[model samples]
Target: MELFVFVCAAIMVLVGALGVVLRSNPVHAALSMILTLFGVAVLFVAREANFLAAVQVIVYAGAIVVLFLFVIMLLGVDRAEDLRTEPLGNVQRPLALVLGIGMFALLTTAVVRSRDSLRFKGDGVKTATLEDADGNIRQIARSIFGDYVVAFELTSVLLIVAVVGTVVLARRRKSERTAS
Candidate 1:
């Protein structure tokens, strides 16, 4: 049963990933990304990471995807862009390809070197069980709220500041446009 669930979730993830890459429409791609996120959430559930699964669905699938769709709609990407246009000149593609190959080579070398050292060493860690499903979540909550509460609250304040800054900049641009 668990194997079946994992296989189904894996298939959803792969299909959604392909949709995200292959779809030409930004809205469709964002929807595909939601599918991918849901699949990942399902996988997290299978791994007994309920908190992570909820975060995956709520934060990524809900908030992030909606933001992406909003940006896509706001940008009005309905018009097809010319693929042949070299806005950055001919050097950009070659540079990107070379850099991509170099990064891939570096990652491959790192993986090969570290493959043997990547063994799981969870010695005294408590995992979720049927009797205590919230145990893992409680531990995570304690670590975050107890040990890192200040940092977490600081991050929220930073995000709020960023949102306010963006709104101010947007309003300034609109006023400038109207004045012009």
Candidate 2:
């Protein structure tokens, strides 16, 4: 049963990724990202990291993706033609392809070489201190609030700025139309 769930989640992740890459429209790509985030949450649930799964769903799938769609809609970038311009020059596509292929080869080599030597020994040092399910949640909370508080605060401030900037732009457009 677990295996089945994992396989389904994995397949959905792959499909969502492909949708994001292949879709011409920005809104469709954002929707695909939501699907991908959900799939990742499902995988986290399968691993017994329920808090992580909830965070993934709430933070990435719910909040971040909504912001992406909001920006896309606000900017009216849903049209395919608006996205057709490639500013990286004519050689960007071929260069990206070569780099992507090279990265794939390196990753494949690492995985192949590590298969014989690398192994999961335990819950890991970070989580080994966690005695119960609640401990996992506490550990995660500590990591976020205690160790990464500056980054966390910065992210929140950045998100707030983005939302405010969008509203300002929207108001400017409305005012321009009224004055005209």
Candidate 3:
């Protein structure tokens, strides 16, 4: 049944999310991210958003996660971090955890308030679907290019800058080791 499938996908998403946070190894975390993305794609498919689901799998699980793995390998900083060390003194991790939980609670409350719209996918309920003749993805592209073009381009530029910075840092570290 659809309920069963949705439950399974939700469980996989939670497990993958926990793995991403709980795993010490960066590679394992990246792999878990792939799992989380794939699970999200499944949820999209269950919602009848086929194009969105495809893009989620192809772009996020495929390209972005591979980029993450590439950066991890290139930086050669994939070693396990010492979790016991509070490098930021005593106030960082606890504060972060508190903020994270508060944000999660807020988002969960928002989603629960909008639960009616979400019931369409699970119960075969008739609700307003976004797609028509032009398609849901076309609407997405229009918004991305028409309304948020500047932000979109800026995001791409930011990603390129991050990649360049990572490469430069890796090279600098290598040269430092060689000189030493």
Candidate 4:
């Protein structure tokens, strides 16, 4: 049952990734990214990483995707306009297909090779217990506050900048429309 769920989640994640890459419209791509994040969260839950899964859903699928959608809506860019200026040409399609296939083959080979050499004593989920949870959480908190403090701070700053930028852009658009 778990294996089946994992397979389904993996398939969903792959399809979502492809959708994100292949969708011409930015909004559709952002929605696909949200789908991908949700699939990943499902996988995390299946693996018994409940806390991480919750965080993934809340932070990524909820906050980040909403932010992405807000930015896309605020930009007021038409999907038709973007499609007209697509970077890829018909001549490159075959080459791109071949390259993608080759990359997939390489990745499959790597996974097959890595799986053989891996050794496990017990089920990983069983080992990820509540007794260890407190220590792990403490370590993570310390690392986030210490080694990754600058990155954490920078992320907050970036988010603030994005919010301000979105407000300014929307206001400018509103003013322009009024003037027109």
For model 4, residues 67-171, the per-residue Cα lDDT tens digits are: 888878888852534554677688687798999999999999999989967775642233246567554455556778998999999999998998899797666
- Report the poorest 10 consecutive residues by lDDT, candidate 3: 119-128
Q: What is the C-alpha local distance difference test score of each model? A: 0.84, 0.82, 0.82, 0.80
Question: Compared with the true structure, what per-residue lDDT tens digits does model 1 show for residues 1-180?
Answer: 999999999998989987886676777888888888999999998887888999999999889999888888888984444446638588987898799789989999999999999888753435788898788888888878998999889999999999999897776666788999
Give the alpha carbon lDDT tens digit for every residue of 115-160 in model 2. 9887658544233234564776877777889989999999999989
Winning model by lDDT: 1
Top TM-score: which candidate number? Answer: 1
Model 2: worst 10 consecutive residues (lDDT sum): 122-131
Question: What is the Cα-based lDDT of residue 148 in candidate 2?
Answer: 95
Backbone clash tally for model 4? 0
Each prediction's Cα RMSD? 3.4, 4.7, 5.8, 5.0
> What's the true lDDT of residue 138 in model 4?
59
Superposition error at 122 for model 3 (Å): 19
- Could you tell me every candidate's TM-score relative to the true structure? 0.74, 0.68, 0.66, 0.66
Model 1 residue runs over 4 Å out of place are 1-22, 80-91, 119-125, 172-177
Candidate 2 vs 4: which has more TM-score: 2
